[model samples]
Target: MSGYFVTKGSKFKGRPLTTLPVVLNQDLSRIINSNLQLKSSHDLEHLRSVAQQTDEWTKLTVRIREAAEASQSEH
Candidate 1:
């Protein structure tokens, strides 16, 4: 292993955000995205203005067999 790296805003709350891929076909994905935006009031207004919203969409996958927090550099 090399070294550990944590983002500026990340705090050691004894846990981290993670996910198990929730695959959705285009139809299902669109439903989820629309509902999220509607509920958030399309709160991500900057994203709405863009022509293509591919970046706004999360591809939904992360694969890491193991990771260790060797150390943390605090902000």
Candidate 2:
């Protein structure tokens, strides 16, 4: 728990635990690589564009709430 903040030139119990080994070999590697390959969504809606639109709407909503609060306070 407390012994997990990574730093350079660090060793653990002896064998340099700073770098973790990723075992991507043989059939496992081929299957993983095939599955991990990027493919576009079926509906033609990209995640990045949807995310940007959601962010813009959230910001506008926050601004509208703040303006309403300010008007109430002034009255």
Candidate 3:
């Protein structure tokens, strides 16, 4: 699924922060986007480990992580 990240603060907040759109497999997308709360960072890490089992998903996750770091630096 494709998604955009919206800035939370004021001053052009509604604009998308990252230029690239995220594309995830249906199962992965469902798990990540689900309402269920991850209990802790370890849970998230475990999820990432599972997703990284596929080479395509591993690359996508790296790109997503880099984009997120870049966006954070901009603020």
Candidate-wise lDDT, in order: 0.29, 0.37, 0.47
What does candidate 1 score on TM?
Answer: 0.15
Candidate 2 weakest lDDT stretch, 10 residues: 19-28
Over 4 Å off, model 3: 1-53
Show where candidate 2 strays beyond 4 Å. 1-52
Clashes of 1: 0
Of the candidates shown, which would achieve the greatest lDDT relative to the real structure? Answer: 3
What lDDT tens digits, residue by residue, belong to model 1 across residues 1-75? 011222357465865534221222222233432432212223334334432555444432110111111112221
Q: Tell me which residue pairs clash in candidate 2.
A: none
The CA lDDT at 66 in model 2 is 64
- The digit string of per-residue lDDT tens for model 3 on 29-74 reads 3343343223345545555666777985676566556656666798
| lDDT score for candidate 3 against the true structure | 0.47
Clashing pairs in 3: none
Report the candidate with higher lDDT, 1 versus 3: 3
Off by over 4 Å in 1: 1-35, 40-75
What's the distance in Å from true for residue 4, model 1? 45
